[model samples]
Target chain A: MNQIDGKSARALLLILSTFTYLLFGAMVFDKLESEEDTRVRDEIERITDRLKNKYNFSERDMHLFEAIAIKSIPQQAGYQWQFAGAFYFATVVITTVGYGHSAPSTSAGKLFCMVFALFGIPMGLVMFQSIGERVNTFIAYSLHKFRDSLHQQGFTCLQEVTPTHLLMVSLSIGFMVIVSGTYMFHTIEKWSIFDAYYFCMITFSTIGFGDLVPLQQADALQAKPLYVFATIMFILVGLAVFSACVNLLVLGFMASNADEVTAANREPPSAIVLERFARNSLVESQLFNIQKHSTVGVLPGRPRRMYSIVPNSAGDVHLRRRSTRRSIQDTVCCGCFKPRPPRYRFSLTRRPTNISHLVDLELY
Target chain B: MNQIDGKSARALLLILSTFTYLLFGAMVFDKLESEEDTRVRDEIERITDRLKNKYNFSERDMHLFEAIAIKSIPQQAGYQWQFAGAFYFATVVITTVGYGHSAPSTSAGKLFCMVFALFGIPMGLVMFQSIGERVNTFIAYSLHKFRDSLHQQGFTCLQEVTPTHLLMVSLSIGFMVIVSGTYMFHTIEKWSIFDAYYFCMITFSTIGFGDLVPLQQADALQAKPLYVFATIMFILVGLAVFSACVNLLVLGFMASNADEVTAANREPPSAIVLERFARNSLVESQLFNIQKHSTVGVLPGRPRRMYSIVPNSAGDVHLRRRSTRRSIQDTVCCGCFKPRPPRYRFSLTRRPTNISHLVDLELY
Candidate 1:
């Protein structure tokens, strides 16, 4: 109960923090852009008034003209509901980048889009995370192999690959992707380099304000198939790489947070036993009595298997079963419910040379 | 290595699946909306030509008129970089809705926006997840306490809260928020009920297509402060509720997937021991000799304390430590690195009454 309260308090605090951050961002933006916004508004208004005076257009006709002009901007891209444009739109929707360059105008189209995104977004999220994890793992494996080759060459440098090494690799890859994308967009779209870079940042982050969407001018979506393909690939691949960085960063952050939480919330042990097993130390013998209990899913009165790990300090780890009969009891309260009290026991000891093997115990 | 290969293969498969899904969605959207898109394009072109003929305007003048008209749409919302509108934009950016209603026009604003988003998006993500988790925990605790009260009143009808119950509650809350938002937008913005509902869905999904954005209709950002506040609250609160539903669903999905992966990848046990303690059965003499090994974090040559949990049959659990001196050997390889082989041991044993407490073991 106390744990729940603590978590709730933390969540409330985070909510407050986010709102405060938003307010701060808003103030900064207003300070930076309000004058520019006013200037643009006045310039556009002056142009509109000049055009109205030159054309001598009626109020209703001028309104209709503005409506037609505003509506025509997206149509200038040429056949947005055609296969190529539709595919681009699909990618945008699933990614939640949602450039809003071309949206479904028909009611049926809108309904289908919602239904499609309902499934597609989650699928995209899972797919991106999976690919991201694979990328990280590949980087780690490559680093390990590189270190091994260095060791073989008698250079006692570039040791084991840590999470930090993987993070650095992913960050560099992400940077390279952004730089290449910025260059490509600048060359092909005739956008200034800084604008191209900003677009890359916005698109990759999935904010995608769409103020300067690609493939909209000169009917590029239909005319320049290669540019279109490159743009789509860049968006997809860049997102995957960014997801890799995010995965590593979030995992590290969460692990440290978990340690802090445990330290703060854990009850002190009644008895302390000091045990030490230094790294590179050859152990003589260590036996781990493994105990697993089925709490949720197992048929009542069914026989369950148990095994202990006997790591022979000098040889391979062995699994041994202790043949002991224990009498079974079934109380079977409402739906066989059992209320368990919260009990936490903290222990620190050393058994083997393999930390990875110990972490893999999570598979159970 | 085999596990990594399997994971890579799975990621590759997911990527392929998502691409195929995108292709399928594209084909369907093309079939549904292509004809309507053509009709709208033709209508807009006809109106533009008619106006051009009526006014007999030069090509350059007509082009300038269209540009001015297009630029004026955002200005219609009234001073977009003002405090209220800027706050709305900030909200949109961090939540990743990115409505594209009014993006930063100045280079400084754009640079600031990117930097702000670099930190704000992650913070928002963490905040939402934390709130979602807290909401679930609160619901579970409330349900548990309610069940306890029922039992005390001699009802004993309701059981413990499950993940399914929490999901349902969250889904209902999400549904209510959407319905209420739809009604409010329909009444205030004067949009069709279906369009209002669609707007709510798009906004809450963080898609923010901007086709039917709420506040841009009648200068609502500046003129209707109460409405603006309501819309912002709806977005933030709705996202939080949906996150709670997503949290429950994703966790349940992942838990089942983890179980499947473990079952498929785990090697067959070399030996087996049978033990059974049914639900509501009082555990007797369950001594968990927790041989905790300090794998990563502890000063070299420092003594780490170890403890064992001895759960008494007739009383609360007890902690006991057996004192024994064991000689330590420090191999001290490169950086004192210790390579651990992959070792998995499976065991089933009787445990004390708290399953939550056992699951909380992950905190370590």
Candidate 2:
């Protein structure tokens, strides 16, 4: 369709434009700031030279002071505009996840940052939206397939897999990532497990707290480019996973409160529809769509009385009822297969009309 | 109503849970990390005392090394778990905009960060959404009122203000914020105008490149709690502003490329719906909603000779057309308002029936 094509084109334009802006920023920063940096470094050298002369400093003392001087000065030196730092700068700029470890120092660089970010931030959001959605949907599709396979292999026969199950799985996966990152960082930094975990959590969350950064080891610093690249992958994938978990959470919240009634007849649980609602919450809108959803419980075929309030236009909320009061048995995965009796005694006395009303009911 | 109440209730529940978690984390971190911090400080003090006696070091040299020792230490001097830090930690946790200036150093603290973020980020998103949407709608309402007043004053007889005009106004407003922020920061930091602007861009964008942070003055550092609190306000309101601008950009992109047919006559340009595209893109689904569109550029009453490919349920793309093109005029604002003749000269060849084919055009 022209719509999709047009959008894809516009998106491409935005990306290309962003790259051009980034390169421009990088070049301007390198050209303008590298000299200022050298001048500052020269000034430090002069001061230390004067101190060495004035204090009758021995070679060892001079060496010590020189090291201190080097440490105190901004470490960027002359390489700020080079590929590694520029690439890192580019990532920081676009993501708006400023590590604060490195930045554009010159006036031009600052101006460029303002101008560049004016375009870059939205472009970044679009990128994240595009990538995050794909990654989320792909993960969901995979999970669905895994569930389907489980059913096929006689693992279990459930009508619909709930968000609770998905959330647990995703959370488990996230926890695993944190644990593994902790191990890796602890090994590399030779820090306590606690410190490593803290670094990973902070980094993965896009907080870039910069308090505990990596590759301060002199040898490791030699490969700053590689380090930056690896971290970018880590952050991107970590965010994608976190987003998927959040997506499942959003879905869980939306679907948690379906008060279903059991009866002698019912239709099968339909697949969840991923509809588009425009906001920054791409995942939340994609969460639990209630178009034709009736009994969102474990046993879909069991006839149940369900009251769902769907918000319709013109200031009216449409309350649909699929009512049946029959006790149903659901065999859930706990350890062994056992049929659990569904509770039909509890039901909501209040029927809500609109979204606000449904929200009022704590239906989630 | 109940649903809204329920969501609000759930949201509150999430906040309460997060607070409890934060308290637990703060207490645990205080108990565990304080001992470690004290041990390090004791060692540093012992070494300095011994050094003072071991060698007849100059007082100035002793002072210099002391400064170095303090700087090299991790700066969390028994203050990590205090209320001020804990509250700051909470903001970092929820926003995921980790400044990394201060972080939890204990295993319990690390675990808490992971757990807290799992719930807090969503809550933050919801809060941001609520605030941002309210702010957006309010601005739109105010803008509408301004336009209404303008119409009443006989500025123009236009029935509706175009998205382009509104976009320019918002953009100008956003730029003004940047310029004003730059000025404020420059005076406070005693930095060049460019550096100030850069810092603002980096900070507000959430990249937070720590190279140029705020409130480093001696007095400000003494009042660290107030500084943190103020900075929190700065970040929150800045992010809200950024979100609003992005929302408008999303609207502009979605509404810009309308394939409208010109009639013998036309109505004025109506405002874009911007109602509920509940994701980062607030306008995608809105652009194509043609039911109420009156001034769609090309023609009013007469239809356009345009081919559209709509996707069907069975993996097939359907090509449909409602054709009959006539000339139209559009009044757009640059510096001044001018009516431009609609171009009927440019037309597409090789009308695509599928997404892939349309993508092949590379319209960008």
Candidate 3:
């Protein structure tokens, strides 16, 4: 496949997989967990019966009493693959947050979880990475363009002030997300802003301490699905902005060292042509798209040089120039490029820059 | 820093960080939670007094009576970061488990968590990866040596059978951890083995449900510190073996294709000198102390060309033969090899095998 086409499809695959995954997970979890769910409900009702007799509460009032008391039940708690619960489960699984508030109780559910995680975790990562790049490229391009626009308007300090400016903007934006979410959670959960802030921080980091879960209010059970939906939006946006901040951090680090890299190698851009050999859609940006809709081009022959941008350590852009001879060997005979002894090769390419990457690069 | 030395130091750092982090976390949590602990005790006493007045339960039976009634009190739940609780909190924070069964309720605690995570998460990952590599390399070398011993005994099929054999052995070893853990948990918690199995799976995956935590007996809280210590050991070993499996999978996949790779590249082994240029101790492996003890040598002139081993997108090991001219440039002029346009570069390295890496490399 043309790498660009392949890259573009990968992002779509993330969405497609999520929908199909959710559909199947919901069905399977409901199936596997229903028996256990029924037992839990039965036990709760039986206890309610005993409590009503002991406390002299009415049958209708007994349910309210059980709903309140059921929280004390050590085992067989609720949220067993009910739609809200299942959706919540799926979110945590894909995000790899795995709060364990609820889990697959049956063998079948366990098998399904193993199978689901095998694919879903990678799928989620790809989606996060792709969207993160788009977000980063958007920010980088915007900041660059903003700087250019300012320069055009005779504001000349952008060259010196740009990194700090970008960081400030990114930090403020990330904090805004925290503040806004804190307010919403504060109002809804009647938690103090401190509690809300703590929750947001825990969540966006994907630590997902189940202690501060939503749908806790007695009144919210009827609107459980809506709550899940809101929670989803809350998490996704938080993740995106959080990822953007991380990207900005990387760029900031790189820009800080940009002077050193540029100063060290003013030797007319080496004839060496480093290509980003990654599966990520960042290579799709080889044919730059300003947005998903608007396609643009780097001047035909002088396409901009890209190094590995995303940090997950999977689709690192290979900086080694594919020599023409190697390119031919790559096409006519495929294995030459695939089996180069990487152990020795990394040692051979021991420049200071590569060494820096060794530290900065996440092995994932 | 030499890559081998760096990698070697990393494992030690993990242990060191855990101790320092635990010491600080324990101190902080104990300080923060002591106030709340007293409040909870007071509330429990007051509630016991109310129940004692209403139901004529004896003062000697206060704890048993409240153990039943204590379930009703919503505020001031258990798991306060006393020495035991604090230790658990530190484990979750470093591991990114964040079970939230017991989070810091105080503002100081919350702030500390964020700061702690900012450093600890990355620290933990580095340690996991380093330890995982050491574990993998040890296993691989041992298995290889084992196979050689079998061959010395005149076994012919050893080469063909080794990879699969190693996998089976590794798998059995991993399963053994689970079974032993299940047994211990079942006996301790008086849960069925099936429930124990569920807890182990949940805990190892870092999902940490908090639903079936250990040492729940009224007699056990007095030994809560001991229980916490046991839980830490269980989690650490589980994480270590689990990580080792993941690393092995990467090697296993690459080794699976070893035949195809060797068959495809039959040209005289190019004079490719592969030096492991890690900031890790893997290059220290070049000075092999088989299992962190004895030292060895890299044959001075004839270096083995290594290939890309781990498929994680970041820091992919590239197998390239360093040509004489490039070697000079690499040594004399450090920057010449570093500057390459990344955009057109990925497109330039198109080959069928490379495309497969795009898919197969990310099985993680």
Number of the top-ranking candidate, with DockQ as the measure: 1
DockQ of prediction 3 = 0.07
List DockQ for all candidates: 0.28, 0.09, 0.07
How far in Å is the alpha carbon of A5 misplaced in model 2?
Answer: 40
lDDT of 1 by residue, A199-255 (tens): 999898898899988888788889989988998999999999998887677644433
Q: Best by lDDT, which number?
A: 1
Tell me the lDDT of model 2 at B117: 66
Model 1 stretches astray by more than 4 angstroms: A252-364, B149-157, B252-364
Query: Taking the tens digit of each residue's C-alpha lDDT, what string does model 3 give over B30-64?
Result: 34433444454455446445544654544544333
lDDT of 3 by residue, A194-224 (tens): 8888888888777777767665565352355
DockQ class, candidate 3 = incorrect
Ranked by lDDT, the better of candidates 2 and 3 is: 3
Candidate 1 vs. truth: CA RMSD? 13.8
